[model samples]
Target: MDVVAWQFLLLVNPNDEDAALQQFAAFRAALEEAGGDADPAALLRDVIDWKAGFHVGEDDAAGLMDALDELASRWRQRIDWGLDDDADAVPDTDAVLQTAFVQLRERHYSLWTAETGEATLSGWITHERDEEAMQLVAGALGLSARPGIG
Candidate 1:
């Protein structure tokens, strides 16, 4: 529905573990208490059944992006595989370094669209992350970071 602001969360477990059910239960309870008009609890129920890492928030884009950027940076560092130690190890800067940034940017936009009701929240809440939709969101946000990537 039309949410004034949104908080998007991405939770991950390297092993693809299953802790989302409990967390979602608690989150739904909180949403109920907050009087989520669109019945976010129901929306979340549909979302968490498949996408364990996805979570919503209440009108907090800046905070969300900051968190995403931090998460992206950490993910990039981990995935870079020690390339940071030496220039020689750098792997196709344009192709490799931008992957995480792109992913993060996409996530930011997807959440925004869903939150703003520009796109249907249930439609956006899919089992998989929609990279294309994310790209659109990032573009709108003018998301930029180091080396002209967002």
Candidate 2:
């Protein structure tokens, strides 16, 4: 894989090289679909699945929760969002995310959010120790990343 592809692969699918290659292909296709002008970060936002990270829509609170839970499950962790999962009323997105961030930090995992210029919550979680490493990867991708809290 090329350097960019390789870096993206590592970010989205470090444990499975084959899966990373496939996700990279999807990202390339997404980029082309955007008339070659989509923010790279946006295209990459929802690319990774539960196996790695998550890219979810802004209004999709359930989706966000599911993605977060799935990602956290990798480390045998979970978060209590302090609400019913089946409730029709969605809690504040930022609040819920901030809650998740705090909960994850206790477990030594960092949840990240990126500036994708879209109506979406896009990010992934990595070990706290990987915060610097995540910055380097985001820099390579030419995107800005930050911890996902309120």
- Which candidate number would show the highest TM-score if scored against the true structure? 2
Cα displacement (angstroms), candidate 2, residue 50, comes to 5.3
- Each candidate's TM vs. the true structure? 0.29, 0.76
Model 2, span 1-150: residue lDDT tens = 246645855754546678777778887887778874676665666567555767777878878888888877766789898887577786767877888999999988888887667677778877787788778878877777777752
Q: Report the error of model 1 at residue 78, Å.
A: 7.1
Worst 10 residues of 1 by lDDT: 118-127
Q: Give the whole-model CA lDDT for all candidates, comma-separated.
A: 0.34, 0.74
Once fitted onto the true fold, the runs of candidate 2 whose alpha carbons sit more than 4 angstroms away are: 28-39, 49-51, 84-89
Judged by whole-model lDDT over C-alpha atoms, candidate 2 comes out at 0.74
Residue 55 Cα positional deviation in candidate 1, in Å, after optimal superposition: 9.8
TM-score, cand. 1: 0.29
List candidate 1 segments past 4 Å from native. 1-19, 31-38, 41-65, 73-113, 117-150
